[model samples]
Structure formats: C-alpha cells, structure tokens
Target: MTHRPRSSARRGDHSHGDVHLHGHGHAHGHDHPGHSHPTGVRGVLHGIFVPHSHDAADSIDDAMEAHSQGIRAVKVSLVLMLVTTVVQAVIVAFSGSVALLADTVHNLSDALTAVPLWIAFVLSRRVATRRYTYGFNRAEDLAGLFIVLMIALSAVVAAVEAIDRMVSPRPMENIGWVIAAGVVGFLGNEAVAVYRIRVGRRIGSAALVADGIHARTDGFTSLAVVAGGIGVLLGFPLADPIVGLLISAMIAVLLVGTVRSVGRRLMDGVEPELVDRAERALGEVIGIDSVDRVRMRWIGHRLHGDALVRTSATTLVDADRLASTAEETVRQRLPNLDEIAVRVVAVGS
Candidate 1:
C-alpha cells in the first residue's frame, strides 16, 4: 500500500489499498536543534559583530504573521535609512566630503531597496493560480536580484565620484560637520541592520537578510567617513577620496556574497542541513521503515518540500496513519515550514 498526505487539513480517503489524508492543525512546539546562540566572550563578540540567522526568541510559526512582520520591519528600516541619508546629504553639501557623499548614496540605495521587498512580501500572500501554481513567492527572490543591481550601481557611482575628486583634489570644508554626519550615518544604518537581520532570521527571509547585511556593511563604511574627516582635519586632503574609493571596494566585495545567496535560491539550492533534519524527522516516525528521500526549497520566507518514506504498513488504514505522523514530525522539526507532502510505500513491495 502507498499513502500520500496533503497539507492545510487532515482527512482520510481509502480506495483499494491506497490512502490519502488532508487537514489543518497548529504546531505547538518550536524546538530547533543546533540553532542556539553561542556562549562566553565569543558570544558577546558575535552578538556585537555578526547576527545569528535564527533566533528562538521571536520565531513565528504562522506564515501570514511572518509576512506581516517582514513588511513592518521593512517599513521602519526604510524610514530610518531615508532620514540618515538626508542628514548625510546636507553635511556632504556643506563639507564637500567625497567619503560622506559615497556613504549617503549607498544609504539611499539601501532605503529604496525596501520598496520591492515590501511589494514582494505582499504579493506572496496571494493564493496560487492555475497560471502560476506557486503563487508570487518567487517575487521575493526577484526583489533580491534588484537589490544586487542597486548595490552594484551605487558602487560604480561612488567609485567614479571618488576618482574625479582624487584627480581634481578639492579641499574639504567643515570637517567637523562631516564627522558628525558620519556618526549619524553609522547609528542609523546599524540600528536598521540589527532590526532587519533579526526579523529576517526569525521569518527565514533570505532577501531581507541580505539587505540587512548590506546595511551593516554600510554602517562600517560610514565610520570610514569619520576616519576621512579626521584625516582632513589633520591636513591630509587626499584621505577623503581615498576613503571613498575604499568604500566602493568594500561594496563590490560584499556584493559577491549577496549574489551567491540569491542565486542559490533562484536555482532551488537549499542548505544540506535542512534536508538532513527532514530525513531524521521522517526516520523517527513510529511506523516508518526508512526515509527514502527528502527535497525542500524556500518560497519567499517559507519552506515547502516533499518526502518519500518506506513503511511496513500493508493496509490502507495503517499507511494513512503512518503518513500523517511522518508529516507532522517533519513540521515540528522545522520552523516556518509551510507545506510538506509525505508519500509512504510498503516495504519489500
């Protein structure tokens, strides 16, 4: 006998020796093994410098709720980044600091990146249609590609401006205001980074996580603007353009990781660890003989997959029960799991 279970509901149908089950229920547990924060001094440093991708403190089990949270995070971060960019722009005009100008340009791009992400999150909520069976979830990945282009464009613009300033060697004015603007930029970008990364990890949104990492890099580059201002204060006029060039270089280097991450999703590549976890969950089910195969992918921030399991259950009733248990086990193991199809086949058949 073979059994296939459906998601979003639980009912059973029997025909011949085959069984089909479907229905919906809530999962109460949120225990994810090997996804805990580090301890000791390393933990503190990691917390300060590198944010974890998963945090149990705010994990949302509901898909719709996760989408709502993602939109809210984008909205708030967008406002903060816009304010920071405006403040930096005013300072750049008064101080003529190429470094500040570079940072401001990148920040503006970062803020605008939120618009597409917000649209994506909203589009992901639509029901699947006949023409687009997977719904609009892939819009999120497309938004990620747009973000990559924006980052690249900002890098090119910054590099060109820095080179021009280096050639002309203009004397920077109001060094103190430039330093103050740098401080403002760092604070704003860092705050947005922390918020976006936290929410992105909580919801498993790779696009949002990439944006957050971008913001974090921008924060560090803003500090470089401060360094340039101090150098100018000490009478090194070339330092401003030099720091601008370095910022452009940093952005170009950082673009590689974001591209790889978004590309992996577009190619349907998932972390091996997620597959391993699904397999383990299936194997642990009471009536399952073995986990034959597991395949998973990210659609927007949610996980959806299918698995094949072998079972000794020879009758339709036993197979249906086994399939339901196996599916539930996998769901409990993985947070933000939107859907999973479990197929059970009789062993030695």
Candidate 2:
C-alpha cells in the first residue's frame, strides 16, 4: 500500500570510503577522510581504482541504493527468458504452428525490454540536479510498465496467429518433438519463476517482482503449449489452435492487470492505509504526542515518505531526540521501508 517516505538520516553520509568488515561481521573501518576534501582530478582517479561493491558504492549522483542481489537475478532471468523464447520459436517454425511462432516473437520483445529496465535502474540513482526534482524515483516504475507492455504485445501477436490457424488449419508433422521440447521448457521456466518471486520481493523492487511473476505466467503458458502438443500427438487437430487461443487469453488478461496496477501508481495513487499504520506504530513511542500526517509513495514495493507531525515545540532538545527516536522506531516496524523522514512542526492555534 502507501506510507509516507522515510529517509535514513543514519549516522553519517557515506559518500566514498573503504568499508571493511571484520571476520565477526563488525564495521572494522570506513575510511573516507581525504575523500571529503575537494580533490578535482585525484578524486576521480581514486574512484576509478577503488573497488566498491554495487551495494557498498554510493551512486555518483543519488543516495537511492539498489539491491545488488535483485538486479543480478533479473539479469539472469532475462537470459533464461531469452533462451526459452528462442527454443519455442524454433519449434513453432519447424512444426508449422502459427501459434508458437507468434509466441516466439512475443518472447523476442520480452528480451529486448530488458535493456531499458537495466538502463533505468542505473540512471535512476543519479544525483538530482536543479533540473530534475524528486530524483529519478519513477525510473523503476517506468521499467515495470515496459515489461507489462512487452507481455501484452506478445499476447496480441500470438492471438492473431492463432486466429489465422483457426481459419486455415495446417497439419503439424512432428508432434513428438514439439511435446518433448515444450516439457523441458515448461519445467525450466517454472523453477526460475518461483525463485525470482521471492528474491524480487525481498529486495523491494517492483520490476523484479513483476518479472518473476511474469515468469510464472510463462510457465503456465508453456504448460498450455504442452497440452496442445499432446493433443496433436493424440490425432486431435483442432486442439492445437484451441489450446493456443486459451493461452493467449490468459496472457492478455495478465498483461492488462499488470498495466493497470503500474498505471495507477504512475498516476499518483495514495496508499493511506500504510501511512495510518506507520502513524499508529510511531505514536506508541513515549515522547510522540500525536500522530502527525504521513504521506507515502511506492519506491518499488517499499514505502518511502515523510511523516509530518505537530509536537510540543517547547523543548528543542527533547524534540530532536523524540523525532529521531520515532524515525528509527518506524523503520523497525516495516520490512519494506527504504527511507523515512520526520519533520517536526508546532501546532499553531
């Protein structure tokens, strides 16, 4: 749902440093003392030589960090989806199944869509200049939309081919080969789909999650293909186009649903239920007088936002302590929170 954006104004701003961990998993050292000094050429030179893990390294432009594990999973997913698509396309061509060829073209589009999604993730982390406000927060959302579009386009092309087949039926010669290839593809994609779903959600990236679920959808479609191949093997001619049509329908429905969800987010839908929960949980803390207003948006699946509160403006010292405490408190309350910001405002009568 939606909750206010939260920023982790944690410890110190870690710009560039060597963060070495001890054997026991303790912060051994974080040395960036000279990195703060304005060294024009030397800074750039040191940066090039420094080896920072993607998770460890701050984006040169923005502080919005991405989950390295999740990104890697998508890259792998793209590779698998590509391979399977090719396999299906080849099968469809040799068997003279218009339905399979159409599905193949759809898969090709899915592979092409990955390029922009990866590019957006890298670009979204860029530091915001005077020109672009709110950073590139929606880049991930944009990528998610592209993925939905890719799936939809594939479904449409597949459906058209199925219709053509229905109008002019063609006999498939090698039903056995089609069935065998499809079974292998079916089991392979199903396994990858299941793994991607969990990994994507853990990292709170919508595109990754969507892609994972989409893989599952592909698994079902493959199953449908297998069923169609079995029908062919059994000497049922009409079953091929009929099953293909059913699979096409399922894909189109899923695609439409995906598009709607991403569209609402892009249009700025408020997820107030999450914000209310955040306020209630934070209010339980001793110093927090009342729940201010919490505003939230989807930074992937994680809720990111600011909680505006009306505190007793009397004691500045206690107030700062109270605000920081509340911010940390809220963070622990939710698993999907990336950054939480608390703004203290005095109630004016």
Candidate 3:
C-alpha cells in the first residue's frame, strides 16, 4: 500500500491520521539533519578552503524560503561581480594589462551566468502541471549546464588573448593602477564567492554552488593579475601574458569538478551515503522485515525517492500502519526529502 500526505506548507507536522492511503502513493516533508565537522589539520584546511555543500545543519526546511534565499544570493552576487568587472575594465583600458583584461572578461561572464539561474529559480516555483508532471525544477539543472558552457567560453577567451599578447608584447602603462584593480577584483569576487556558496549549500542548489566556485577561482585569477603587474614592474614583460595563460588553465582545471557535479545530477546520481541512510531508516521501522530497495534523485534542491519493504504485519490495517511509520521515519532521517513512496509487501507476497 502507499501513504501520501498533502499539505500547503512545506514542512508542517502530520500525524498518521493526516496521511491518506490510496493504493501505492507517496508523502512529503521538509526537514534535514544537522552538520558535523571532522578533526585534524587536514580536516581543518579542507573545511576552511572547501566547505561541505550539503550540511544539513544549515539547510532551509521551507521550500519557498529556500528558493527565496537562492534568488537573493544570485542577485547580491551578480551586482558585486559586475561592479568588480567594471572597475577592472576601467583599469585595463589605460593600463594595457592583458592579465587584468582576461580576468575582467571572465568576471563579466560569471556575472551574466546568474541570469539563467535566476530564471530557473523563478520557473521552479511553478506548480506541477499535467503536461509537465514534475514541474520546472529541471530548469535549475539546465541552468547549471549553461554555467559550464560560460566557464568554458571564458577559458577559451582568456587563453586566446594571452597567446596573442605573448606573440606581440605590449608595454603596460599605469602599473600601480593595474595592481590596485587586481586587489579590488580579488576582494569583490571573494565576497561574492563566500555569500553564494553559503546560501547555495544551505538551499541545496548545485548550480549556485558551481557559480560560487567559479567566483572563488576568479578571485585567485585576479591575484594572478597582481603578480603579473609586479613582474612587469620588475622588468619581466612576459609575466603578464604568462599569468594570463595560467589563469586560463586554472579555469579549465576547475571546470572539471563543476561539470562532474552538474552532470551527475542530470544522470540522477545521488550520494551513496544518502541511500545507506534511507536503508537504515527503513530497517528501523518496528514491523518491517527487510528493506527491499531504496532509490532517490534530486528534483532541484529537494530529494524524492521510493522504498520497498517487506513487513511482518498480516492484516491490511497493520500493513498500512507499518507503511505510514516507515515513511515518517524516512522523512525524519532525511529532512531534505520532498516526497517519498513507502511500499509495503507482505512477507510471502
């Protein structure tokens, strides 16, 4: 049998009475687990440099709130990045720093990437229609693919500019302005990176997280521009083109992780730990004999899945009770779960 609960709110408390069974169906809930930190120096460095994206402790329980939070993060970061790009562009005009120009171009593209994500967030808020049964949540994933393309485009542009500069060297003027602009770019991108990543992780948005990583890398690339400027000051004209080339390579390297993350989601790949957690939750149900199967996928920032369990309950009423309990238990275990189907099969059947 299936147990599905309906509610207007994202994470309202529901009792067994609230769940109505109509054959094999599903239920919905919005809650998440807490976060835990690892120990040792390695763990500390990892935490500081690469914070975990799916920390349950910071997750938003309300679906609407999560969307709102994602939109806010995108808007704020977009403005910050644009301002940084404009500042760097002004410096690039008179300074003739190829490295700064490359960084500025990438920053501009990064800022534009947020537009598609913002549209996706808005589309995701649409209710599921008969034709679009699953709603527009997949728009977020599509936006993620667009982000990857933008990153690739930026890398290509930076590499080409650097190569041309290397072949025909140009003396950079306003060395101090280029250095100051690099510092400004670094500060701006870093701030946006931190804000985007924090909100994205809390909202379970892979697209936002990817964008944040892009910005973080951009910040470092900006620092490379400063190094290039200093090298030019120290009588090394090749440093500017070289650093620009390095920035391009760095962008290409970082693109791999973002591609893997977004591609995995499109393929419906979920963390193995989440499956293990679901199995353990089902096994904990008092009357369940065994967990037959559990499958989960990401539908935007929320999770949806189904579980099959063999139960010892003989009567229909008993089996229904067991199924309800199992569903509830799974929801509690996976707070980010948007919907879950708990199917109970008789031990012999």
Q: Would you give me the overall lDDT of model 1? A: 0.73
Per-residue alpha-carbon lDDT of model 2 for 47-153, expressed as tens digits?
A: 32121223212211112334455556668777877887777777776778654565566555555666776776676556555676455657878888877776676
lDDT by residue for model 1 (183-205), tens: 99889999998898888878878
Among these predictions, the greatest lDDT belongs to 3
On residues 1-349, what C-alpha lDDT tens digit does candidate 3 reach at each position?
A: 4345555255442222322221132444344433344456534433543477555455675777888888899999999999988888988887787756866776787788899999999998788787877677889888988888877876787688779989998887778987898899889989998998888777778788878877777677678778888999999989988998987876776677678779988999876777888899889889888988888888777777777778766776787778767766776667556667676777777
TM-score-better candidate, 2 vs 3: 3
Off by over 4 Å in 2: 1-65, 85-105, 270-273, 300-302
In terms of TM-score, the best-performing candidate is 3
Error of 2 at 33 (Å): 37
Give candidate 2's root-mean-square deviation (CA, Å).
14.2
Poorly placed runs, candidate 1 (over 4 Å): 1-50, 53-57, 89-106
